[model samples]
Target: MNDKFFIQAGALLGAVAVALGAFGAHALKAMLETSGRADTFETAVKYQFYHAIGLVLIGILLQNCAVNAERYYHWSGYAFLVGVVIFSGSLYTICFTGIRAFGAIAPIGGTLMIIGWVLLLLAAGKK
Candidate 1:
């Protein structure tokens, strides 16, 4: 995707993360505590927020930097987006639905996040 897309997505995701965090803390607090998934929900929100910032940074880099590996920035942004969706999304689903099976998908998202960082590093190493 383009830099603009990444910036918009990041901004939107960041907003959603904030809203969800507040909802979890206020509205869903009792349910989350009852389900013993409050920490998991917090984790999801934290990671989503962190990676949302990362996505914004990636977009800014793509827009302002003159790295020889521009394509890596694109891929890295995509990876971060997908990773946050899958990883944080799955954790959210598990917290809400009490389905442990979704935990299995988190690793894939974590891996994608790692790959995104590695790609960013590769891009930094180039030109």
Candidate 2:
């Protein structure tokens, strides 16, 4: 992806994460209280926000790298994206539906996030 695209996507995702967090904290407070899902929702928002920043960093790193740097950076970006979808998406579903299946998927998302960070570190280490 282009720098502009990555930057814009990051910004948008960051904004959405923030909004989701606020909504969970304030508007959903009562709902969460009733369902006992506040912590789960917060967890989702946390990872979403963290990966949103990762997305921004990936964009910045990509902008400064050589052509050969694209592979690792691109993989890192994809991993971060997958992390957000799987982690946050599963949390949201579990919170709303109380399904253990969603909870089961959370670890996969966390693994993706770890892999993304590792890939980013490897990319940076390359000289």
Candidate 3:
């Protein structure tokens, strides 16, 4: 896999995370407070930041390591990308739209994130 793809995705995710965090802290503060979802929004941003960093690490590992172990990194990194969108995106949408249905999808993202971590573990064991 092209290392640039993972790196770019990670960078973009990190930048978006910061923007979303600030948006939550400022613009969405009042709404979230009124809806009692301030903590939930913050959680979404926090997890995004965490996975963004994880993606960057995956990119770095892929860049430096041999191709033999790229599959795990590839899978894990992509999983994280999807996970962030599904998990964090669900929370953000729910918080903003007051649509409780989105919450049901958050676990799928969380599960994907877990799978990413498990893939990372498998990648490590491969070495």
In terms of TM-score, the best-performing candidate is 1
C-alpha displacement of 71 in model 3, angstroms? 0.5
Q: Which model is ahead, 2 or 3, in terms of lDDT? A: 3
lDDT, candidate 2, 61-114, per-residue tens: 898887777788889888888888999999999887888687888899999999
Task: Report the lDDT of model 2 for residue 52.
Answer: 87
Quote the lDDT for 127 in model 2.
63
lDDT of prediction 2: 0.86
Q: Is candidate 1 or candidate 2 better by TM-score?
A: 1
Q: Could you tell which candidate, 1 or 3, scores higher by TM-score?
A: 1
What is the full ranking by TM-score, best candidate first?
Answer: 1, 3, 2
Q: Candidates 2 and 3: which is better by TM-score?
A: 3
**Judged by lDDT, which candidate is best?**
1
Q: Which stretches of model 1 miss by more than 4 angstroms?
A: none
- Tell me the tens digit of each residue's lDDT in model 3 across 1-127: 5767888898998999899889989998998999999998999999999999999889888877756678999999989999999999999998889999999999999999999999988887765
| Candidate 2 accuracy as TM-score | 0.93
State the displacement of the C-alpha of residue 97, model 1, in Å, after optimal TM-score superposition: 0.6
For all candidates, what are the clash counts?
Answer: 0, 0, 0
| Alpha-carbon lDDT, every model | 0.93, 0.86, 0.91
In candidate 2, position 90 carries an lDDT of 97
